[model samples]
Target: MPERAPHGTSPSHPSPEAYAALESLLRASPRGRWFLAEYARRNRTAETEMLLEAIARIERAVLKPAPRQAVPSNV
Candidate 1:
């Protein structure tokens, strides 16, 4: 039997890996990339933008600036 989603609730957000896959697929085809971006923008889906924003935030968080190592003092 197929599992059902809880009533009045949708599935949770996709994983970062899944979102990265989707972004990669979209970029694979120029036309598809353009269309989805335009459609998503036109529809004004906060969810879509939020997902993209989350991805961006995740990327930044994962790749923060590294602390600079101090050089040895010259004699």
Candidate 2:
């Protein structure tokens, strides 16, 4: 069985590896992507909200801004 997350709390960071794999799969299969759209169109508002939330989480986790470098001091 796959490892399960505990109830009531979510992970801090989404798995980048998993995200890449899923993205590749979706991109490779137009039919699969179309199925997702069909399901979303047929589903209720809550279903769309759920997908939006998940996508947001992944975007946030993997697209964090890079840390800035300090300016050099004048001599």
Candidate 3:
């Protein structure tokens, strides 16, 4: 991974978080399949696999709700 620039800015390359978010969005949104396929084809063999994994992760995240935190009573 590239070192972070001062003030949390990426000097040239984007972060992995950004790539994951984009892959998730591209997989879910309409007309995104074309983008994913084309991107996958342009990249190496593992790119498509990674895209699939990202989609699966996004689906799971959307389907699963976060756990609720219990609050102590003041009474």
Ranking the candidates on TM-score from highest down gives 1, 3, 2
Task: Flag the better candidate by lDDT, 1 or 2.
Answer: 1
Q: How accurate locally is residue 42 in candidate 1, as Cα lDDT from 0 to 100?
A: 74
- Tell me the TM-score of each prediction against the true structure: 0.41, 0.36, 0.37
Which consecutive 10 residues in model 1 have the weakest lDDT in total?
39-48
lDDT of 2 at 21: 83
Superposed Cα RMSD, model 2: 14.5
Please identify which of the two predictions, 1 or 2, would achieve the higher TM-score against the true structure.
1
- How much lDDT does candidate 2 score? 0.82
lDDT per residue (tens digit) for residues 1-75 in model 1: 977789999977889999999889888999978988898787788777888999999999989998899988993
Q: Encode model 3's per-residue lDDT on 1-66: one tens digit a residue.
A: 966678967587659999898889988966897888876777866787899999999999999988
Residue pairs clashing, model 1 = none
Q: Mind sharing the TM-score for model 2?
A: 0.36
| Model 3 poorest ten-residue lDDT run | 2-11
2 or 3, which is superior by lDDT? 3
